[model samples]
Target: MLAQLLCKTGLNSLNLNTKLFVSLMLLLAMATQSTAVVAQTDRLTLIYVSEMTEMDSEEKGSYPKLASLLEHYRQINNHLVFISGGGGLAPSAMSSLDMGAHIIDLLNAIEPVAMVAGKREFSFGEDVLSLRTYEAAFPVISSNIFDPITQENLDGVNDSLLMTVDGVTIGLLALLPPIAHQEYNLQRVEIQSPVDALKQRANELRSAGADRVILTYSCCYRDYLNYFDELDQLLHDGLIDLALGKDEHLLLADHQLDQMHPAHIWITQGDEVAVVELTLEKDAPTFLMNWQTDSMNAYPADAQVQMLVDGYIQRLESLLNEVIADVKTEFATFQTDVRTAENPFGNLLADVIKAHADAEIALVNGGYIRGERQYQIGEQLARRDIMRELPFRDQVVLVEVSGEQLLLALENGFSQIEEIKGRFPHVSGMQVEYDRRKPVGKRVVSVRVAEQPLLPQQTYRLATRQFIATGGDGFDMFGDLEPLRYAGQSNRLIADILIDAIQQSQQIAPLNEGRLIDLSSP
Candidate 1:
């Protein structure tokens, strides 16, 4: 009768009174299987997490909050997957070193299955990425990035990862943006297009008897849109199940399956970043969780996780204390965008480039310029903070190029801003415009120097960064320019100029200008 009742209660097959108590517990779990279900011996569960930069104090108090959330999840389930996107590489003593360590420590305690590289993972260069991976104590995978010469993968320890969870075999492939390769001009490493590589690997995984194949990619929306149709077709044909994307700054709401396509798709914005979540079961249902601003209340900080973050903060504070306080100023912070009306920092940088190169016109990449918040007077500025804003130590170069070269650089600088929104060139003495409605190459409609029409054959002494001079961000035409001179550490020059300007006036007030042509309406 007891056996009969137990069986009716869904515990029948287990001999609870016998030595198989553990086995009976597993059986009961399978029956309930609703809230936080541990996978049965035959089932596997993966919790995906991503876009965790800016969770620290530099942005807000998000660092501790994220750690706490991870810890809470770790206490219940030991399987977590992390894919961090780029953009948190701003210079700061706080997260520069300790951010990844703290993130890894908490996740390791939870026992994550694997962590794929997001583009931001490489935002600080290869060395910083290596250090973070070493400290992670988990698998770091970057399959697409390889050594330029050796062609060996630069993923620290492991390249690709396969894990058998809950009776399901899963294969993971990672990819990065091609721009990263172009930025470093990596000789050995080549970043394959995600679409091309995935199809081949998906076949390989399927032939190897894998039940599911997932792609964790860090790329912009344009890349995703370019390949979305093809990927959706793959899912419809049952070739690949899930594709997660990072790199976009905005958060997308969780979306449902495309009615036209058989498969489901979603993109998540992390806490100050974003990630995509995919559940392999029931045909790969996907969802997007915004970790940056939303989704905070649901997952409060776990005490244990907060403790780990505190330790990292302490280490960072110690390092920051040693940085010589350069200048004392009232509360003021500079925005990174430089294409618009010049901020104090931007104007100062322009002055530095002009001084260093003795050129009439100066052009700087909007990539520099940090300090999103206001700095108070008596605040001792540190070199580290400045460096954070200007992470790339690109030198300033003087190029005596024709007006045509200058015009090309301006157009390329403003290339993806309309589509991607933030790639613009800030200048000191020139203005340019292009028709947005018109095709690429023909977009530039007008060009002027200090209100004077530009002369195509006339050579101008222009000061610009080394990266742009060599066609770093699609300014390939500039590489043909006659070399006038090389000014190293243009960032340093700008920083020094800023310090002096602040000291002389003891006041720094900058404003935004609608200088660069905005073809948004057009």
Candidate 2:
């Protein structure tokens, strides 16, 4: 309108120079107006849920509840992206039987834009992970993990993902801990430095016209401090817009929200969901971010999703409902009890594995017992109960180590007592006394095996999870030592071994024989 008005008001007698100046002014004004229109903010709603495998439990975070919450957002928001932070595929009762195929089926109903490959994705090893990934309807991504033999991303997994929502381009990248290969029993995948992977990928995303870059990492609690520092630097330098973390449940439980880094968010338990709102500036590489966490209880279960969940549950119950044993006493499997002190369930687990391997001693990490609840006296233990308690499907293996190496392994277990790490050992055929007041490596006061004092020079047969025998949970002292009884030698998993033991005994009693003595306890 302004241009037309200027043209109509122009006098025929105006000089050429004057007319040219007026024309230039009109063009400048038009350009400014177009710029203003282009600079409008684009809103994006990102719903992030991590450790989705935890949804299998009878908690508020079940798949039906999450599906309802997501559907609600989908209805209200035009631009929404659902992200599964991975770690949901394994370590659950159902996952133990199906190798996470059921998890993939459930997640397919609530299709995520992308799912990050968490450490637990490798729970059953590379071939199983490949099968799970193949069954996924969404992209499974991990930028820092690759197949060493193929020099490519793992089968059916992507290195990264580019998604466009409401005209805003988003770059999604995921990182598995560098030690994931060792910790998660990864045989075919190799991990690169996450920092290097992020730096390289973020730049590529930006160059490829990404408006925002989000990183998802599955790192254990102890690695969070280091990852946070690196993430803060990336955010400060504008390499990544945001970071979502998984496998930091303990850190999330211990720390306050105010203590968290501004650009980093840790996914809490399955019962909660983190919603991130982003305001992307048009033609600019900046965005405004707001995060809010909501409980799954806020939404009613989607009827369709509920049906699907019920179907799976019904199928699982048929196979798992058989009674395995009758309990004569309360069996404790709470995390605080199993991870920090001698637990009756842990004692039984160690004894079962030891007996199965016919080894002189057995060591079970507190983390291995995951029931997280007590079984009261007179309660019937079912196959389902055993599966939930020992969901990892890890094999029991026997290994021979010098008594000195055994002591070092014991020290490693006691070293992380303050953190209540899973490395804390539950023992059979041995009594260990440790003083927390002493330095980490020097905390072991004494260790006796078979009622005999530990001899540093003598070799002892140790039965443990294949995970520990291969040096998981910081038990590097056991690394590279060939197992006396290879895990593959037995077709039975630890859960299977325990189930047989319970069946043979018919009735079980809680046994805490003071095998793990904390001298520092008052």
Candidate 3:
């Protein structure tokens, strides 16, 4: 509604004071807490978002519609404490601009005091993150991340951040699990063991007179289950007020949190926002932290936040909105489809890379096709569409592989079928027949590439994402294969290539034939 009003009032005609007021209203709307919480004079509200991954309420109607929620909270309470759950910088969010700088500017608009560093934040170099953090109003903190070469703390990351609200001191820290840098083929920082790092730094925060401590971890998975007992100990000992973790898209709400502590919270990129209410009292036993997650639909879009987001979108729209082609049909991909069998979308993406590199064969990990939503037929494909769909920014790599190595790669791709890993290859120039019933290494029943049966002695030129080329998702056979194209160029983002290819073709309706087949006992 605010956006509509501004649109009619001639957005450009709004004076600077009016714009600022609208922006503040938007912030208040976004910060608004769920009404389910028990209101009291001594309570402080902390709005926590994790694995945001560049997702804003404006981008999509995901949970905790931030702009309007902020506006809601701003009007209700003056002492709301907003903190980020990290994973703020993602390729989809950064495709058109400097993501770190842009997100920092955006986060500043709502005035969050601090945020933890999620693992994906390391996708860009530390120098880039450092520059952005320097520009951010809030602290980008991590207790365990550090520079690999100098062994010093990263330039812009801190071990902890302290925020004082209403005479109450709150301390927050971020912990990251060891990452797959070898598999991803990029390195700028190293991480320490999460358990030891959290224990030590948390003690320091409390000793320094922090009345409450909040723990944030960027590794958003149940993979951190091993540390549950340790977290229980921290809560029982009154060392931390809250703990935040994101396991995929799962929303671990207050009920699931009862086992860990009275105040445990989990949030994802979209779908929900965790609002933790802290009740500060004279006695430690009486102090309370209550968490609730409300959907983004719970509030309306604040005019202020809508305008700020509009500015960012409008700045990029002219170039990113250009139509590349019209899709004749819906070529969609879902988690089950991409991870298990070949889908039309995967076939199209793999074909795009194969055509771009002019390689005889090409494949991509299902993990990189992150358009969780499906596209409609007859929709005009644009740069923005590709950006949202294939956001990983992984480059294409052409490599030489023998028949035996190719077979091994295919076997590796299907080896983790039970786990549904992204390594499952979607091929462009090959037909693979595999059996999940067979042993892991012997899963490939038949492999034909470039219209020929596999030959042991012949080496084939294969094009794939650098993630696979560098053995990501456990396709290590590629590490032995030599680079056949763009040997030293690892930054040619496949998204850009896909856009260009779509423009040149003017239309795409990739075949969904027998490229990948699964023959196994159900």
Candidate 4:
């Protein structure tokens, strides 16, 4: 047809060389247009959530609702990938009893492609996490964590994973913060630098034929602001295609950092879910990415997941409903009260831990108390109540520290008082007087242990949570000091100790007792 049309249009009148050249150019143009029309585009949607624990609250994001939302996406796009950004494994009433097994069972139903190993995953210790990993249907990954004994990633945990979604090979890596070692029961494992691990694994994945790489990281403790610079550099350098972050419970719009690299997404709260859509064109090495988030409340609960959640809640309620003790006065567990100043409940907790350890003094971080509610006078405190308040199963450990070191620890506690940090000391056998108007390290005006003036040279037996004794919450003054053990020194869970104390006493009346005095108060 082209030859006949060309002859009629007077192409035959041209010389053979010119006619051939024009014909070749037309053929080339036709091939280019055909390739453009035949190009294939694939879409991958990633559904992300983190820091989830309980499924009991309708006000918050529940696993059932999450399941429904996932199904909605799967219906629209078969290339949907669900990612658990870690957390949600422990520190709840049920998790305290079952060591997060219920959460694992619930997640199995959701069937995430990968679950990041956040610090909370080690809340019950490496052994329990190893067991949980065995139960999980999906891959549990942490790129920077390793077991020295195995000389590899922790048992059952992968350093990275590669999956093909709609013909696109996606590489995944999860990173934990450095503080996991200091804050949790991760003594059995070693954490490498997350940034270095990310770079190494990303290159390896690319070399292994991955078309795109995604990272999910929980960096720092509660503050992720400091990690953005390094993440932006990685994005600019083209090592990673997308980055997902956890721990900071704020949506992208609420973040204080206005200018963020386009590839990063921070999904903190369970109530919110983030979706990252990637469009890959056939024969193209790179892809276009888009991100959006929605509330889990927008979706209805999936019937199967709801049934599973209900069964677990019933089992948990049976164990938690028994009345343990009666309170003579209302005890407050408000974050501001417990973290910024002394409260009656904090006093009771410190006293119980001190008595259990048989130590002269006991110090508990305000952050350890998480009930965040006030127990009214005459309210019967149940086993559930205690667990709700102290859910981490933190053990009481005995240590001997000089009065000078004690002073420094107290200073560290008060250092972040302005931020209402968790390090604030809830004391058992000591009275602290401080003027916040003074410099941070020098805030302590005076300290008395057992009603006697503290002697910097004198060493006192201290009873505190293993977390603090091991340098958590900036209590580095106790660095590398081994726990002291003597006759009858039981390193029992702090919650159990408190429960026993309440059960033994039958009735309790605890007061502030002026343990923490702030001269800055008007």
lDDT of each: 0.53, 0.76, 0.68, 0.77
Ranking by lDDT: 4, 2, 3, 1
Model 1 off-target regions past 4 Å? Answer: 1-43, 55-63, 75-111, 126-135, 146-148, 155-159, 182-188, 246-267, 272-297, 300-308, 311-345, 370-395, 433-438, 450-453, 479-501, 512-522
Q: Select the stronger candidate by TM-score from 2 and 3.
A: 2
Stretches > 4 Å off in candidate 2: 1-41, 54-60, 219-221, 246-261, 267-269, 283-286, 485-489
C-alpha positional error of residue 83 in candidate 1 after TM-score superposition, expressed in Å: 5.2
Clashing pairs in 2: 53-88
Q: Please give each candidate's TM-score.
A: 0.71, 0.86, 0.81, 0.85
- What is the per-residue lDDT of model 3 for residues 251-338, given as tens digits with 9 covering 90 to 100? 3545565666666566654646677777755355645556787666777666666677677778878877888998877767667778
State how far residue 479 of model 4 sits from its true place (Å).
5.1
Error of 2 at 397 (Å): 1.2
| Candidate 2 per-residue C-alpha lDDT over 84-137 given as tens digits, one digit per residue, 9 for 90 to 100 | 888787778988888888888888778676688888888888888777766765
Which runs in model 3 stand beyond 4 Å of their true positions?
A: 1-41, 53-65, 91-97, 179-186, 223-229, 237-239, 251-258, 268-271, 402-408, 415-420, 437-442, 451-458, 475-482, 485-492
Predict model 2's lDDT versus the native. Answer: 0.76
Score candidate 1 by TM-score against the native: 0.71
Q: Which scores better on lDDT, 2 or 4?
A: 4
Better of 3 and 4 by lDDT: 4
Better of 1 and 3 by TM-score: 3
Candidate 4: Cα lDDT at 115: 85
RMSD of each: 9.9, 12.4, 8.4, 13.5
